[model samples]
Target chain A: MNLGSLLDFTYLSFIDACKHSLYPYLPKRRSIQSDRVHLEAAVSWLMKSIDKVDGNGSSKAYRILNGWMPPYPETSGYIIETLLNLQDHYGDGKFFQAASKIGDWEISIQLEHGGFVGREIGVLSRPVIFNTGMVLLGLNALFDRTREKRYLDAGIRAGQFLVECLDENGCFVRNLHDHLIHTYNVRAAWALIQLGLLSGSRDFIEAGRKNVEWSLGQQLENGYFLHNHFRKGQKALTHSIGYVMRGILEAYLLLGEKRYLDCLKKTADKFVAIYGIRRRLVSELDENWKEVSSHLCLTGYAQIALNLLKLFKITKEERYLNTALHLIDDVKLQQPLNRRSEYFGGIKGSFPVYGRYAPLQFPNWAAKFFIDALLLKIEVMRDYENSLIDKLSLGRQ
Target chain B: MQELAKHHEVFAVFGKKGIWDHLDTYLRRRNEIDVHRRHTLAPLLPASHNAHAFPGPVNTLRFLRRLGIPCYKVSHLNGAASVDLLKRLKPDYGIAAVDHMLLPAVIDCFPTLLNAHYGNLPQVKGRDATEWSILLHDHLNVCLHEIVERMDAGRIYLKENIAVDKGDDFEILRAKCQDAAKSLYLRFFERPEECKNLYESNEDGKNYYLMNWELKALAQKKVERR
Candidate 1:
């Protein structure tokens, strides 16, 4: 590290020390531990947030506690998955229609080269591999819901673009959001893996697996991934952390690779260690698997909770469920209730409404991940409770 | 265990990270802290060491959970989750048996977290105590102590001494220490009502860390000579 970099770190440390000293004196406001999110409130947030989207057709942030902003396609695509899932879980046609509209919007904005842009309206609309993957996920789910050939065609084309971008080692060498490689592209790789399985394209599956293999190489012995965020050597947002974890976790689920599952378990174990029991989770972590920031990343919290819950299903370890329940309840507490504003049901980027990564704004993807976590919790609890009942019945039998 | 089950429900059991994880961390930390600043503290670890080949921690936790005890996978002995789960269980007594140092919350929570140290109290009170005791040729005492903020500095619950065999090598000393720990627990728990938290303090003892290889070799030589 250069002298400038050293000084930068020292300055940040000094400021952090000041923040810690002053934090206790300040009056805490907008506490996240307000109330647990009910099913109705969560769904309401999703539908309301969707309605708040701009002409580009993604959920717009209800800014200044009032109006909407430009629709974020990155999150809009994920919101489609959550909506489709809710539609299936609740058997509601409105959610399906809503999901279809968003999916169509994502499809409409997709570039002629079969990729999506990070920002649909403002930016130059250059192809971003991660954005394209998110859209591909939405398109794939749309096809599953409607059995539409257009959605399938769109998803396949997107998968092909990703496959074309893959280098010999299965990395998406082309079209990274920035020049820096993101380890979290495992999610994008997992998307292609899904497309491969769905479309029966062995080549697509091979590309995804190679990417996963490369991802495995990047993992630290302590279960943390290297080169995770845009910055080379700084703390990673839990958002990227979750992205990488979920991708690997889902890949294991799809392929049933013991090696993938083993890696996921190791990483999950580290998170459990750092977070402890029901202690509040932070937004970012350093390379040492230590919390660097105290702010809560609502999406990352939910994402990790879901991952741990899934591991509980597979591993049947009570610890996973216990920690997962704590996180689920924590995020559920963040979902606003009994409010006239659109913010009421929407998950925020950070718990205090002011932190890095979309500070003071309710990102649409946060709500998307929140819904996914909530639904997964319900399903996991149902299965867990059923198993207990089954054992009781068996004992009597 | 069956006797304890007969008297009171052993509601929960806790295991820290699996043995394989411990092995990995042990090697990694050793590599990190070197005599020279160059992180060359890496040891020639056995290539065959794997969780699958040695399913010690996983298997034990499984048996515990199957026996209707809620076995938790904790980060460390004093991990917050362990305490949270313990609070939920609300057991009459909390037993600390894992390898990690007990955190303050865990120590303060139960007020009487029973732990069995495989070394003499006030002498062998820290890591690798048994090996240290064997090296020092101190009384091979397996003392049941309460886990406190200071490692193994808690009040003594019970103490019993074992005569080291004439040919007691490192391996033999380890078995003797473990057997002594098991015996102490069985004896203490035999009359549950009689066993109470005697909040009595003991004299300060030296804390042990990783033993030097040279010292270990010398200890082995002394044992052979004897």
Candidate 2:
């Protein structure tokens, strides 16, 4: 944003460029730890990210220039699900308390119209469609756990706000990113579907389905989604692509319709084929699915890993699970473990920490998605273990 | 295999000798094919043609040639040459003796590609399945199935769960599994059409990867203790 920041970014970019050029020539130094270890470290990072905020919720990220950005309502809202999930996983009361506090903070910040403000707190006061949907995710999750009327009411309001944003064609015509429709908002559709299931509202479900169908129109035959970039006319990063895939997969989970899975397969199968050959996904891909950037979007990897694991669960396809494992293992390797550092346990937005996406920062969403992927990985592993153990028991003499 | 040749036009297509095959051959020459090679009597050891370990493609090829069956070797089953050869062969079905992953190119060459797995279908899959079956299920199984693109995932033709006796060790269990697998394969070949789609698709199965040394060791202990 500033000249100094630009110079700092330029210098880091130069260093990273050099590393990228020499990466293949250098001996591979990847060290992968156990999934449980990575999960613990990531949850700790999310807890620390939450702690950095004043009252509740989580900071947007720990920036290189600035210490910690302002608390982000959008990500912090969804982080409620992560914290509660951690509580269930570890049997710790602290995560539930933390999640509850975040939920309350989100409800307090809700606009009179029920939509959450765009960007981090204090940056803008205008309510946004995407942010409102994300907040609904946390609120609905909190309501599911505590069954509190307040959380339920907040969730319903947020869900209603999202429903209102949708036009007759199911596209969110208001508060779009850069005044352009983004395919990633299908995630909002996912949140709407969740809320619909929670509240048993047919309107929300229909609206959610309509939006998914609308998003499907944006998908090219090559599986690339149009208008998926942060800014119009730019190549879509794996992050937004992950968002699109995740939303469709979630819709399939709730609807139990083959069409949703078919929609996802258009994109997911292409990704699986490309990933099988390259072993890594480039940060950005053009409309033709060509690699346009060399940097690794760690958040995208985590998000896609979570989506792929879910796909595997549904299809029982070995490629999906294998690809998901590779993606998460790569993310696990990128995670920092220096306890004393502010960025400890946090996953960087980009592998080099200076890549175009979220340059020089570790975003909270990255850690959130990483934790989610790890949790899913654990479940998949448990299913595998249980299945094997069940089969083995038959051999008992 | 010799009996199959008498009934059907049986031939063997071996994957080009991998590093393990070369190593096995080298070890066999020095009389060090097994860890207990020096102590155990030669009569106690399984024959070279047995599925105890990598008997090397050369041994198998020699055996097939001796049986007067044609033999072909290829660097990769998915390679252009291999596919070209398969297209010419135009076999009704092809049997896979090794645990190699056949690509769609090779798979499309035949109506069905049969494989024998050392674990139960829609249950145990992937590497080290025999050890996993013993350690987790306390059972041993051998499945004969059609090989699709994905490893160990196909429509099973037969699944025989071999009883794991208290006195059985890894070697004894492996022997039983190999025997069962061989018998299943022959039975399928006897009535190929009847064996087709005998069992349902293994859609519920998960692809288990190679077990870690720690788990493998634990499995070994379990097998020996039993």
Candidate 3:
């Protein structure tokens, strides 16, 4: 299927599934246990979706979830969601306390103008655009949850900061040498969409829309986004393609624009056709369709693709939903311990230290993806409480 | 004593940089004074006999001679030479400063050897002394310990535990330690018997660590605590 069709299918399915699962849980509803189970599962699946991409102890995603130092805003979003779910189910305040602790840290790190100073990159310690965008999204989620003026204000500031980073044509200028404009643009767009939607700001929304439009215009006739601007080339890579898909989809969601959604569908269709839905199913599969690859970079892309699939489902697209299911199944098959494992619910990338390619090490980002993927899967399947309890038990085991 | 003067010799080894260079110039001036006094002064050149080669062994031999004993420069010690020089010098005592390797027990058999360590005798005794000290953020308690069978466990000739300022780096601390070593050396040489009696017993409780990730972790923890 083409990228557009697949995304359309995925988005439709996601919305339908979420609405279907959530309806029974609405206030004054019966079957509270069933609703709770479903809600927990959905959150778990979301957590797992992000967890699988965690690298070896570095990355913004991982630090938020696990680091001893100040937690990242993005990771705090997941924490808050988990805490809220627990509070809803068990009426426990401890979860609220934990969430508040992280929330406070997030608030403190928000720069005066609204976004965080990008954490130093790895050991080299450089700031970059991607991290800034990730942080903004996290803060935006926090604002949505708390309705705190500070968080919302910080979110607006961060949104503005990201907007200021865009060039005249609304395209991001970072990673120019790699010529991966489409990739960075998508993240930038995603952040903007969150800002625009949450803050009810047209500028942020327009900025995101422009970014998506520019990205769509740059798509090659062959469906692959161009790479390496210096050489002026084009080749489809799962990673960049996933980023672009996410951006376009998020832009469509934020604006509820059929045109943006149509463009996103097209991109998603192209991505599925190029990579093949079947081949894209497995987490760490190789370019040649081999199963033995051991690198984190490509595996991380796979996790992103899975996330995009989840987004497609929300948009009520069946093709996207089917593709996501197929991919999830493929990933499950490749993960040997999935049969007995609860913690390994999300997608995983290569971790060099553990001698497993796309290894599930304790890096911040990898853990975040792992948690995200698991949460998303659980939410869809409505088995979160059991899975979470299972995971906690596994930890003890 | 006159016969011993003819048969034995004492030489001082000095580097070409830092305070050592000044000491070398001062020694040359001292040699001039000796010449005017009609007394022959020992050679003031580096330990290396060959100008083109490093004088590590020559330096070692020169330090050996400074133990208030008479010793003639061996052929190997005469020029840029090899370990064979150890056999030729065949002295009663050997002393080393920043030499490349620890002298083997067989080599030490020829003479009682001493080394000038830049760290406190029982504490910071190893290579990269100053770097380790600053990284550990240990107060600058440096000393010149005599080298024996066990590395820095040898006799302590002199020690000075100077207070390190918060902003002090390794280079600055090293310079201070060098000055302390020079002054301490002068005092020790002035009364060798008194210096020998000042040696205290070394306890084995102190740890000698190898640099690794654990040390890096420890340093991070220390910073966090601060």
Best DockQ among the predictions, by candidate number: 2
- Pairs that collide, model 2: A391-B137, A392-B136, A392-B137, A392-B138, A393-B137, A395-B138, A395-B139
> Which regions of candidate 2 fall more than 4 Å away from where they truly are?
A1-30, A392-397, B1-226
Give, for candidate 1 chain A, the lowest lDDT window spanning 10 residues. Answer: A26-35
Evaluate candidate 3 and give its CAPRI docking class based on DockQ. incorrect
lDDT of 3 at A7: 55
Off by over 4 Å in 3: A1-99, A111-114, A119-127, A174-182, A227-237, A271-317, A333-347, A351-363, A370-397, B1-226
Candidate 1: list runs displaced more than 4 Å: A1-37, A54-56, B1-226
Candidate 1 vs candidate 2: the DockQ winner is: 2
Interface RMSD for each predicted structure: 21.5, 10.3, 31.9
Candidates in order, TM-scores: namely 0.62, 0.67, 0.42
Better of 1 and 3 by TM-score: 1
| Tens digits of per-residue lDDT for model 2, A139-227 | 98999898899998988888888888899999988877568788889989999988889888988999999999999999888888988
**What TM-score does model 1 score on chain A?**
0.88
lDDT of 2 at A24: 34
Quote the positional error of residue A352 for candidate 1 in Å: 1.8
Candidate 3 residue-wise lDDT, B57-170, digit = tens: 334334455555444432222233424555655656455654234545434544455555665556555544544454443445566566665556777767777656544434
Docking class of 1: incorrect
